[model samples]
Target: MNRCYKILRTVALTPSIGPSSIKIVGAQYFARAAIAAGEFNSTRDYASPFDADGHGSHTASTAAGNHGIPVMANNFNYGYASGMAPGAQISVYKALYPFRGYMSDVVAAVDQAVEDGVDVLSLSIGPASVPSGPSAFLNVLELELLFATKAGVLVVQAAGNGGPSSSSILSFSPWITSVAASITDRRYNNSIRFGDGQSLIGTGLAPPTIGGVFFQVAAAADVCQRNITAGLVESCQDADPFIRSLVRGKLIICTYTFDFESEAATIATVADTISKIGAAGFILTMDPDIGYEQIKGATVTLQVPRVILNNMESSSALWEYYNSNTMRSRSGIDIGFRATTRILDGREATYTWSAPVVASYSSRGPDVNNALLETADVLKPTIMAPGSSIWAAWSSNSEGDQYIKEQNFALLSGTSMATPHIAGIAALIKQKHPDWSPAAITSAMMTTANFSATPGVPILAQQKNKLSPTTPFDFGAGSVNPSKAIDPGLIFDTYFKHYVQFLCIVPDVDDMSMRRAVGVGCPSKKTDWCSDLNTASVTVSNLVGSRKVTRRVTNVGELDEKYIVLVREPFGVNITVRPQVFKISVNASRHVTLFLVATQTANSYTFGEMVFEGNNNHVVRVPIAVYVSSTLGF
Candidate 1:
């Protein structure tokens, strides 16, 4: 039976939108599989394409899982879960196992997926870093994707988790659509109210204690009096050391340290320890040495009332309150445990209604060329989508994060979660406009993204611990607007040959490398400038005095429309577009020239946009990024 079908047998979901039917097809597993024991099993090769790790299932369902499925875990209904395209079909190509796999296996999977005639290819994987080459764009993975694009497959990939840092994008080829992660309007928070009437906020997904009344608190160190334990006994790892009488009805405080991060300790074990000792509930405080939202399995559902103080300040305050109230002897033996608190039921959901913020972990870009980090004239990630705290399908095994096991659903985060949103949206577009090329589809999305928001509210990006206005590097064309994209009046389409020509002109790439990468020699006629490639976005990594580039836009709408060009010029560059106002008939194309001149030398990158607003309610936007080196030098 299909893996998804097996899961539906257990879901008591009254699905409104349906997966109606999940027919598994073209299922193949090419990599050596790894089971839960962390041992490689060669005999498992060519087995069923079942998701041993929940990550693949989460991503797969995010793109095309059945809609209106109630997200249930720990016997609590958090909310309804849905995919971008519920009616779409899924074909599994298992390249990597739950734990890890080789790049060669990944290559085989991509090649096979393309051969199997899949419409869209969504990959939540990429190179660890910039691949070794004169031009990182020519790596084996990039070349395979280039060929896939040539075969009319829309490839979407994770933009890497390297983060708010500049020039950290891993997706290099313009042919592939790279995706950045964003936090959604939904927020998950739990609070603990102390006896003094002060409440401290924390994170968790669990039910509240049986009653609303405050319960006495007990420290793990006091209850688990293990004088000769090997690990951090305060972590509450073992039930043997616990003084059950003291912990039976109290909210036990457990320490979260690096051990939890390394899997030496786990939230599952802590929950087990709490159960074994019959404690009323548990509070996991951050170990000062490792603070901030680094708690793994923090979102896992616990049957017991639980709260994870992920922030240092909140953990410190809770600790301070506990220490001040407790009376201890000179030898540090607890004489009295007086801290009292009640954990609120966190299973209920809440909405912030705030605009999606670029996740602090999503890789930013100026699309670099080499390992030295020379910026390239390409934009990445091409778009952004909700990737943080997303609730999606999970394999009960939970092989990826062992701390979370035997759950049919999971709340996960990463750029990996974002990539499939674009892929699913692209599939919808392809279904509507069967004749549209991959480039046309990509342009439609780029030009119409970030549309569903209140006017004048600039989308902000999370930097380290602060929020700032996002740039093209932070979110390519902004968050994707699927509705507007389906009717984007104008699209900048690219040809496979254009990519070949662009590769020939890349800064350090040579003819020999080009032959090896693409299986073809450079065309006799050399392209004048790399920026001339017809893409929805324009970027000049190192601009000097001035440069002129031309872009051709095709009318993809049903009627002729007149459009006026608008420019939000970059800080140090002045822009001019000829034939500012023009009309184009349906199925026709128009070429526009943009003249950019250096107004002042800017040592850093500055951002801007060029918009084409049509009379027929179609808006096309193109992001521009430029780094000015010198006013008069190359």
Candidate 2:
């Protein structure tokens, strides 16, 4: 076993959780026994649930780690970190290793977690692609989650990393609350001031050059005596070419190009090359031909001071400044390098209000009906949360990101990061309402999410190079709102039978296939279809003329309240709700009927919403998305 397991086992055996300064991981005194579901590395090393890869520790701490723990890295203190639900207990179920994982092991972990009576399950992993089966919902992992949900465990999964593309979602089942990634209000920005007094904002997470001293800058090509072939030296990938005398104590400039993206060169390699050559720091300027630049993952961790000018304009301006200040000899060989710059501290965080935008890498919707790219009526990415640049607990020996191998914490991004936010919040909800079903908890969160950025303005999504208005396909109910969700006055509750019925009416799935998948046949009489699954949102991929929908709500609050229904119709459809206003007593249920009528055929899907304003300070929102093909049957 690894040294981390030895430490974890020692900590686990201790009866007391101790104090904040004790440096507790996710599992503490409240944790049960850690279990490994299968053998990995061809060894019976399955007994210990030690998180050597760091993903488990990162996700677990993101969900329910101890509160007010200081996040220290590289001799700098970022700040205090806390999980969404700090008081909740945690149990490790090791299923994946650093290199690879198998579905059989994941299934076993799910079965074991459910059997252990865990109230909430957070999965930051998913299939490489949509599962190949009769239906994506019929896959073994999805069915295991279905059974877990039936047993009252709320399951949350990552929507996948594929995004900004249509039908790129990996989590397509309705029972699972798939989460999408979004940018938070926090941002880290660094700047470098040239000797000419001009400054350029860039990305890095390291301290400023020591003592406010401006370091002499040199280009990798000029300092290296070797002939520049294919311009590989410009990226500082080779240490053999550099002359230690010219490079020592100088800030070196490197080029970031398509080569970096193709894995031919990497930031880790650049950092290693600069460190070995005794350079004070480095700057990575984008090659204009690389088009859009993306610097993420472990590259964020920098031991040496550095700046990555990631845009064309910034990179071009820097190059112009460098060339003007630099002096080359007549033979274009030995010359006086006069360029100088100073890097500023970048570990500090800056807060802004313009965020919660859907990340460019978060998977998008129009949940697929099967593996064939067919559309389903259900909305994908049940909700969005802060996923970009999230800092949480990490194992020092983690192999997930080599650049950050020895660090105890990592700032990462993905739908994987967003999922634990919901899972932790769900733990909070479950603590408050022990009797609520998984669907009720899901409905509470969905119906109370903030669909708009501000008043009358929709939350936007990052579409490749720009931001655009979004729909239910982008973020199901919108970004999650923890404050409004806990006291969601009414919730749309679902049961195991509802999911079975959902499969029964799937366009291409017959009762025989459904039975073969779930081992349960559909009911003899069925009045519901795919779109009428009683979720918090309404979606119709193809709407001809009109459709009638009914929703049932249960008031869980203490007092009786009256609610008024308001509608914002979609572009090509008119929506009407019956009795526009109604009152209900505590614990009472009400049925709301909605009728949608198409006025004209729309070339694309349009978005709208139905809101319920309660006298008791409760607002319930239901999103509507539809593609109108015709106003009448032709």
Candidate 3:
């Protein structure tokens, strides 16, 4: 805890009614553990600011961790570690307890954060499922976030780690900046070299020095007890004492059945058994359905060398060698393997085409909450950030429990890791532009984000390691570029009233509940509820021919700047802007009408974008998505 405090001076450890003037405030533990232990928590506890789970520490450090601290994971050094905004102070709010969190506690924490005058709120937590209709009001956290934005605080949230699945984003409130997880350019590659000169690449986070001389190889089934069940033995699940003698000096080969329930446990059991029996090494084989993309394994300190073979062909070759006559005649087959790794240290290399892709676990979105609203189908995951295999500060108390070792730093992956990166960037933006509204700050970040890190190469998804084109639903306005975000020329701005109008338009949202959420009543003229929403991105679904939408933008750059409108029309759709070019004075605002006309009847969704390019090199880009209905008429 002291080490973390060194990174920032204003870190609040406990909730206090200290001077309201204080800029940063932290509440250690807002939620108490449930009476019964579940997957995320081990026991019940009281409210405190301390992080016993290590997640809070990791996220806090990622946001504003101290600069120039050497970090390592699984015995591999990753050089110095620093947060996205190392100079920014952080207020730690510990709303998450162990693995579980109570909505009441989360709401209380947000109240305290707002009262303490925090400029930015970073929440790496959310509801477990999609929020829509009346259930949306039940989201106390988001309701509090609405109040926080009203109080001039920018809230950044995790997009949830449920991805490769459409409509998986849970944080759908347009008032909050939802973040998705993306891969960094750096990756840890662990390879295995066989005696026959056959080599295969895989993923692991153990020490790179776990390779050497060849050892005898034996299948886990061959070494299991005679009385053991065929199913259990074939899966290599249990590490019984009887099988220890057989695998004592050989490399154990284990196969995964791809059973989601038992796959993880099976791998752990095999690794534990190998360590106990003093095996030279272990080789993990994937099911045919698992695919060839190497899955990042857990970070562990292993006594023996271990490598995974994600390719079916490689696993087949090894199996064939193990079952060969030469190996049957002997006690076990001789095998050669080496596990080595290289660290990129955060340098951008064009030769590497695998990174900056959407992580398979990072959530996708179409903003399910907006499905019920006629005009307000908002896009989610305001932006993407590097979240996979991130190294950050870990709680010393949680060492060896949640973390692999008793160290102040650890490597982790999730949207939880991505949220703080945006939060830190938000902090910088807030510091630079203190008067900017939360929506303006979000607009700046969204409009200025880069679609792809490398020119001409579309951002890819990590699932198949392919360069397939992704949608705004996959990555909203693209990945965040902090440098560009700091100076977005024109920002799409909104206020609490706009969001309240948005909620009023929600099909089933009650007026009383909406009043409680925004502390206001629905206006008498609510006809233009959705059209009144001013955001950076535009989405229009079920369009037959022509549809018009209005967008208001405020010039935050130089006075009397002219921005030429550039439109990339979606397939089967022609977008025309009235008054093709516009000029705005400093701090002045302008509204533009966009006419989206379908050139031909279409049955699918199409995507395009509009770029407002200024002569001074300041560009404000807005993504446009249109879905044409196959039906001819309404």
Candidate 4:
């Protein structure tokens, strides 16, 4: 794993595992485990830094996995595996355990990582929902992250996968870079062919090819137990002897019944039953009411060909064929099977229908933190990354793992997969510019992100597979462009104190909680609220007429550089910047005030952008969103 990731340091903080178990080439290793596992929490365990669950290794390797390692899955070589920052080094901190980890253990890990002087912290875990009130302040993870940010460590966290729903982002704190998942160019497209010359498209992993092999198909209902209970045979859940006898040497069709959906219709359960009964193959049809939509990836590995038919029309036709009179008179219907094909040799293609779309499960936000206060609600998923079906290094020890077969590399998906990409990018940026602050690095990435791959077309969403316009809430500051980010002419930077001030402006958050969070008291003077925040993005809510927002930009480019402000005003809103053109010397900064006037009240949120173009072709863009009283409730 170290050879693949170019790991600089491998640290083990568990009592059970040590440095010897963690194999890394040319990497300094360290171990520090708290021996008193039960002292911190009852759930705590003294485990080794070795990744028993395989998640830690996956994420770590995704961030800095070594370059040019052969990538294989299910004994099929796909390509070479490399991380986003393969040149960068990784240092592991074993803070998690199988399934769960104690909060105290995680805090200890964070404290140690910060103390050890790591450049960037990639945490793939988060609460399912935003914590409220004092709980928010008391959250050990958030508090530790605050300290890390204060110490100039770039913290990247997963915007939890509880998504496809608005306000589902869990890492709500503004100090950390919360990432959302998006589909990459690569996908596993499986095809199913029937004897009727009709073919259907589906998705799965390691589906057996079975090259033109034709087998007789039978519905599970046709192989019911004699005198079976009502609905038992139809559900196809039990492994009864009669059902097994009927299914042996035949492809079985499984459909979702009420009992199956409620009790036994998972992919694992269905696949296990089919394998145990000696079925030649399995065809899983979607529930009729749910309509058509193929499950995107593999849920489990199967020895036999397994195809999921999500299209309602195709599945309905198959169901009819299974119960047809011709089939009833005969022993069973003949079916032909073909395995999924890998397009572009499983390489990513950005311009295709599936490319550059937000993963259906990626979290969305108009961050629910401080939801009651219009000014305090922050935009989350600081950015999107390639998170779907990413191929990266896997733990060798975790054989028979559900996510990773006995291979050096595995394909996985989640915001967890996306967070490390940014972390690795941050590490690269840090290497290029050692003096840059975390906020400056964040601004560089955000201000220079590409919103669309093609001209006049915004990035598409994977779930809808359409080119619908998305908002900042959908993809905050668009997607990260590492090459452009390294030389962003100007950056909107903020310090820890700025966040404290912003928090102070939040309604219902008391000073006591603020002190507990930042270890600082609110200033005597009132903060400018959200207007004072110098973020790369601008948001103004509940605007009745006009409001002035102050922002400062620091020039990080050549000396004597001049930047001209270009405003794309939101609909019904007039935007003007005082001193539209300004000059700044290297290492110098300038402040600009934006005067916004609402020409008409907006019943919904409106969006625009301000572009600062430098003479040298360096551009820094800031997205602007405005909401009127009618839309303030959001």
Best by lDDT: 1
Candidate 1 residue lDDT tens string, 397-499: 6455555578788888888888888888887888788778889989999999993357988899988878888898988998999998999999999978999
By descending lDDT, how would the candidates be arranged?
A: 1, 2, 3, 4
Model 4: pairs clashing at backbone N, Cα or C within 3 Å? 4-65, 4-66, 5-65, 5-66, 17-48
**Span of ten consecutive residues with least summed lDDT in model 1:** 1-10
lDDT: worst 10-residue window of model 4 = 1-10
Assess candidate 2 and give its lDDT: 0.79
**Candidate achieving higher lDDT, 1 or 2:** 1
Candidate 4 residue-wise lDDT, 503-608, digit = tens: 7777676688777766788878866655567788887766667778888999988666888999999887889997799988999988998988878776767889
* Residue pairs with backbone overlap in model 2: none
Candidate 1 Cα misplacement greater than 4 A, ranges: 1-22, 32-40, 43-46, 132-135, 226-231, 238-241, 258-265, 289-294, 370-373, 451-453
Cα lDDT for residue 44, candidate 2: 30
**TM-score (C-alpha) between model 4 and the true structure:** 0.84
Residue 528 lDDT in candidate 3: 47
lDDT to native, each model: 0.81, 0.79, 0.69, 0.68
TM-score head-to-head 1 vs 3, winner: 1
Q: For model 3, how big is the CA root-mean-square deviation?
A: 5.8
Q: What lDDT does model 4 reach?
A: 0.68
Per-model TM-score, in order, reads 0.91, 0.92, 0.86, 0.84
Q: How accurate is candidate 3 locally (lDDT)?
A: 0.69
Separately for all candidates shown, the number of backbone clashes (residues 3 or more apart, or on different chains) is 0, 0, 4, 5
